[model samples]
Target: MSREEAVQRVAALIKGIKFCMLVTQTDQGRLHSRPVTTQEQDFDGDLWFIGGKDTEWVHDISQRPEINLAYAQPDGQNYVSITGRARLVEDRAKLEEVWSDFYKAYFPEGIDDPNVQLIHVDTHGAELWESSGKLASAFALAKGLVTGERGDMGSNETVSLE
Candidate 1:
């Protein structure tokens, strides 16, 4: 697929997914992953996430900027894996723009809370797997089983975001 089309497909697949697993490398070189709320915004090769300044993930990003984000929509059988470089940003304007009252649970002091921080991910590339639907997938699998061939599960592609 074309680069732009690939990006749009990814955006559509992850549209309503509220959270994704953010994976980072610890100081000891171990990979750690945690679920984080995805900021409500359009996907355009960059993603924004709100986090706490004192969080361990923040520290990991500071030490190792390379990170991975995994987004999944099991009901639709769509999954996206993104690799990128992340940095801690303190952009007040952006913080205010993406801020939501829901975050008060974590930053009780509001947007101005010192602990509130932004994680900016500049995506380098992504791998996406999307299925036609459950019924189609089942049929394909059944056909494959009978014919002794691999099932056409779905479209899988690796696209460069940069």
Candidate 2:
């Protein structure tokens, strides 16, 4: 598929996914991943997440801006992996823009909470895998068995956002 088409598909898949695993490297050189909610908005080749400034992941990002986000929609058999650079954003306007009631459970003080912070991920590139579903999966398996070769199981593509 064309790069433009792949970008569109990646945005679509991400829109359907509510949560993603945000991976960051610790100062100790170990990888750490945590589940983060994606802010509700158009993808636009960037991702925003809300977190506390005191969180370890935030600290990790401060030390190492390079990160990865993994999104999976098991129901649709769609998966996306994004590599990017992240930075802490303390903009109040942006905070109000992405704030939602769901975050209250984590930050009881609301958007004004002193510890509340925004994590902005500037996406560089992404890899996506979209499965064709059960019927197609069965067909692929059968075809593989008959031909003794790997059949087309799904669509996989790499998209450049930068």
Candidate 3:
């Protein structure tokens, strides 16, 4: 697909989904994964998230910086895997902009808490897959009839494109 097409597809996926699993390398050089609150996608390959400073992910990412972020539909069909280096951003203004009702369920005290943090992952690459196979593909066709667009999925190098 063309650059714009790829981006549009990624944006659509991000819009339809919110939660993602962020994996980071620990101090002892071990891989660890955790579910984090995804904030927003500017559709420019940068994803925003909020987490705690004292969290294990914060410690691991602080030392290694490298990370892998994966998002998938609950049915286990559509999925996106992004790899990149995460940079910690502590800007207060940006924090309030991405809040949702779900966040309060996790952090009731909100962003002012010392543990509150934001992470920006510069996605260098990604592998996206959607199992809209034979059975589901037909559903996509029907949806396209109404929406005027088809759901196409696969993987690509977001980092190399730069």
The clash numbers for all candidates, in the given order, read 0, 0, 1
Q: Where is the poorest 10-residue window by lDDT in model 2?
A: 1-10
lDDT of 1 by residue, 50-123 (tens): 99989999999999999999999999899999999999998889988889999999998998898998989999
| Highest TM-score model number | 1
lDDT agreement of model 1 with the native: 0.92
Q: Least lDDT summed over 10 consecutive residues: which range in candidate 1?
A: 1-10
| TM-score of each candidate structure, all chains considered together | 0.95, 0.93, 0.75
Residue 123 displacement in candidate 2 (angstroms)? 0.3
Which lDDT tens digits does candidate 2 get at residues 1-162? 565666687889889678899999998999999999999898887789999889999999999999999999987788999999999997889889999999999999988889898989988899989888967977999999999999878989888888
For candidate 1, the per-residue lDDT at 29 reads: 97
For candidate 2, give the lDDT of residue 78: 86
Q: For model 1, what is the error of residue 103's alpha carbon versus the real structure, in angstroms, after optimal superposition?
A: 0.7
lDDT of 3 by residue, 1-162 (tens): 565666666666666566788899887888888887677546677777877788888878788888998888745466777788898998777777876666666677766666677877776666667565655666777778889986543233442313
154 Cα displacement, candidate 1 (Å): 0.6
- Which residue pairs does candidate 2 place in steric collision? none
What root-mean-square deviation over C-alphas does model 3 reach? 6.9
Candidates ranked by lDDT: 1, 2, 3
